[model samples]
Target chain A: MAHTGKILVTGSGIDLTLLRPLEEAGNSIVARPKLLSAAELKAELRDAVAYLHGGEEYASGDALSTAESLKVVAFMGIGYESFVDVDAAKERGLRVTWTPARRPDAVAVFTLGQIIYANLGIRNRLDERYPPQWSAAVPMPSELSAQRVGIVGLGSIGSRLAGLLLTIGCEVSYYSRTRKLAETTLDLTYRTLPDLAAWSDILVVLLPENPSTVNIIDTSVFARMKEGSILINTARAALVEPVALGNALRDGTIAVAAIDGHYRDESVNAALMREFGPRLLWTAHVAAHTRQSMAAMVDQAVRSVLRALDNAPDENMAVGQ
Target chain B: MAHTGKILVTGSGIDLTLLRPLEEAGNSIVARPKLLSAAELKAELRDAVAYLHGGEEYASGDALSTAESLKVVAFMGIGYESFVDVDAAKERGLRVTWTPARRPDAVAVFTLGQIIYANLGIRNRLDERYPPQWSAAVPMPSELSAQRVGIVGLGSIGSRLAGLLLTIGCEVSYYSRTRKLAETTLDLTYRTLPDLAAWSDILVVLLPENPSTVNIIDTSVFARMKEGSILINTARAALVEPVALGNALRDGTIAVAAIDGHYRDESVNAALMREFGPRLLWTAHVAAHTRQSMAAMVDQAVRSVLRALDNAPDENMAVGQ
Candidate 1:
């Protein structure tokens, strides 16, 4: 109990500056930036004071069930679906904590920018930009002022995104199991999932990925949306049925799609490129890579690990809350 | 004037609707869409009603100066820079009419969309999406409400783009020689070019590609721009000095640039993309490619041709004006 060991940040691509307090506390720090898959972490499970996980897919059940010396597991972002094996961690006397994902103002701005550009065909134009030299820029665009936006699962991030849209003059509406106390200036209207689908010119998926939320935007949702309406899935790819989204895009039911999650393969982007023709605007899963947010993310993650060491639970992120 | 002869519509990718009305006007339309390259026209200039010139580079003087029965040389879009040996056309008694470009509402929407979206970085996100991925968008996205947009030319399209930005709550400013008397609530400040550049977050160019406009966005203007500002050129690539633009991007004097011109090849886009790296966004010269705008462009060209044939002199667009 009196032995001093290093805090090893596993899998999460957290920045090194976050371990400042721990370093100052005179503890050694080991950080593996890449998100580690289950198949690769059998050996390193035993020698860590704390570990931070990344993304929505990583293994913790088998690793946690046996790693007797593992004291804490800290999830930096809200999504702990990948790293949290609560029952297993709890049974093994290990503590878990997660810092709920905040909207990260920069990400919201980026989203609004994407909606304006994609709807107006800005990204598509670049895809078609002439090779070697471009003489002119042609924008095939629609107006945000003219469209209705439906945001699903209006949690912290979604609500923040909604506020940004309202600021930009978009008619913002939301569909959530619960509502929060928001300013009326936001002009946010709450609707059922089905009604939200029918009313939106653009539907944004901002809720976390889970079993119940899988295929939330199925064929029926596509059919309900106004023809040629857009779908922006920054939430999770599973929220949108890929086949349904594809069918909608091909038939022009959904005119264009901009996704930040759910497909990172070249084939997917290439298929989308071919199927949507110019209607699809693809960005390679980089919706959240702002300089500010990254720095913040790394700082938040490292802080969470230190709090775990002090045995003063991370107040912001209740362990397994 | 009495003889009914087959009319040849010369120009590759010439909008068919422009010539479609010519057929409806009781003329036999012999359409040959060509790129004005050496192989096609010189080989068969005899098989020509009018020789329609495209918006790219123009034909040689001898090609047009020596034509015997090329009675009508119709220049497709606004700038007659593409065609018209005016002295020769007058000497031959052949009519040369330039369809004055009307900054169509559709084109304006496209321009606004690109301006907003380029700043957002949508294309990179959507194409790059991976299921269960995390990344930040832009670190310090310039807020639209907080921005001062400077329009270099207060001509038809420039003015319209300003209006659209105004509708989205952008503080619009301009540097036009003449005063724009548009009804608006926008704080449209009429400033000098250097002042406008200094004061604005985004600068849009919608000037004619002329000697005066060539290299207008040079070092002086770029230096005047606020650090980390976005520059948009939907008018002409020549407006930007490629080297200056490249240097600004490298030095971060201009944070990001979205250009729609300079499409001899990918040099402009590539240079910006390389020097700027994840900051610059360029498109193949396609800022006015909406369904409505394309139809409007074709309709305008055809109507212009018809009006010239009917002897209705549009003195505003005639040679002197």
Candidate 2:
């Protein structure tokens, strides 16, 4: 039988204009605006050549087993392992690809913005009706250029942030799995996590979440940080222990912090919000939600689907092919 | 009679440690932690060879005539014209010097911080407890690097900000008194104020308060600006017309704005605060209040006093020597 050339898009809210390139390539789109059940996804996969996964619905083993024509499972985001059953897809001889592009810049820029907001004491002055009374007792805020910035991970986002910090004349250091020799030319120094914490006036956490990485920034790391230093975490919240973070904020081990990603538990957020107030800048995981990044990821996901359909998947983005 | 070597400091809260350089030069420091009256200032100036003029007290012509040994009026800040009688000082052969150093970087950094704060929609997400619901209807925020930044003045602070913006990959343009030949090499474009407003995604007001510059950013400029554009003013409050700014915010001609300086009138602040809540990020004139800048200015002021005492004044800082 000839190919149907149908691509199934299962997401609550995907921009149709971004899928124009896929349609222009002579493929028909079967878009399910809301997340579908496993049985519904199985039925939709039977006619489609590729599935554009939207991260809400899990592509279960049963769904993969039922698909007759589906060659690829293209995830719109980086964390494909959580949504797609890799072994099941491999059993069905299907390619699983994800878009891991354009997010590093988005997250890095937002992290820098938060760092400045904290360092400049913008929160204290936010609600002041009158002008700040300049006095000897009231200490002045330090300049961004004069700060020593230590990044926890030397991944794409961390390295990009390090470069941005260097441009602003900040002393940049990192604590990664291994020291990057090439980055030394860019004046990046490698340090142990504890030492990085001690030396940094601004410690930024950007590590990926894994078994070993989860809760890595605990009480020990907080204890080593400079008094009145800032902490900026744009990474997963699981990397930082909530109890340790709350203690650090309470005892003044860390002067201020801005966390982009929050805990899954509503009670934890409520507790943190009630206890810390403006000292902690907590936000939902929206650091990588820029218009530029969204458009780029969507385009990359579509390209990944098209490439997989042609039996030539991108090695960087492919998981189990 | 020999020189008294006495320097009168007339700022309410000047850091004495910053004035140690002057003391180490065999000078006796007369620290008056208050804004003195003209009669009180004249009485204090009779014995002092160099007067460390603070911004608060007005050095009138009557006060200048009373000074017997005062050779230099070393203003601790840039705006000497507001505090010192230049014609009176010039007639008495007294050198007037003001510290105009180190503030550009301070103000520029703060301005960049506010720009990022506005651009990233941090204000919107600041109070959001739940994760943002991503949908096609909800528009995404633009990346800072993708922004076209239009600077109202290419003076010290504006030029420094333009350079900082360039390092982050922003398209920078300026409207100044005259086109800068040297800056064009750095990829800075010269535009008319209206053209700049129209082209910019972010408009920064950095002009000094003068007859020609005051109220430069009025209704017409706001009308020319891109819809949903951000305005950041770290300069004088008078430069931006208050009524027009309120109107722009009300009608949504501009999405958000961050102003560091506030008007003198209490009623104006109260009215604006009541009307535009989070759409405006208002702060006192504390953008240039960094520790580094403060120390540098105090040291510069001391050096200017020392140089004038030796009959060798810094020509760059001298007004009417």
Evaluated with DockQ, which candidate comes out highest?
2
lDDT of 1 by residue, B165-271 (tens): 76555788898767777424445889899999999888888777655677888999988887778888887677788888888877777766777655444466565
Give the residue spans of candidate 2 off by over 4 A. A1-16, A20-73, A79-95, A133-138, A306-317, B1-14, B21-74, B82-95, B133-138, B305-318
lDDT of each: 0.64, 0.80
Candidate 2 lDDT at B65 equals 90
lDDT of 2 by residue, A55-116 (tens): 35678888888788888898877656656888898888888887766567788888988998
Encode model 2's per-residue lDDT on B1-321: one tens digit a residue. 224488998764366888887778788999875557678988998888888875356788898897888888988765576568888888898889887765677888889889988888687687564436555434678889999999988877888888878877899999988887636766798899999999999999987665677789999999998778899988877789999998888887788889876675667877888888777888876777788877787878888887887776486455654
Tell me how many clashing residue pairs each candidate has: 52, 0
Judging by TM-score against the true structure, name the best candidate. Answer: 2
Candidate 2: clashing pairs of residues: none
Best model number under lDDT = 2
Q: For candidate 1, lDDT tens digit of each residue in A1-321?
A: 222466666533344565677778767777665545565554556676667664444546787765666767776566565347766777777667766654355555556666766676565445343322222233234456557999887776676778756644578888886775653546689888889999999988877765578788899888888877888877656678877888898787877786765442347556767767566655544455444555566576667666666666566554443
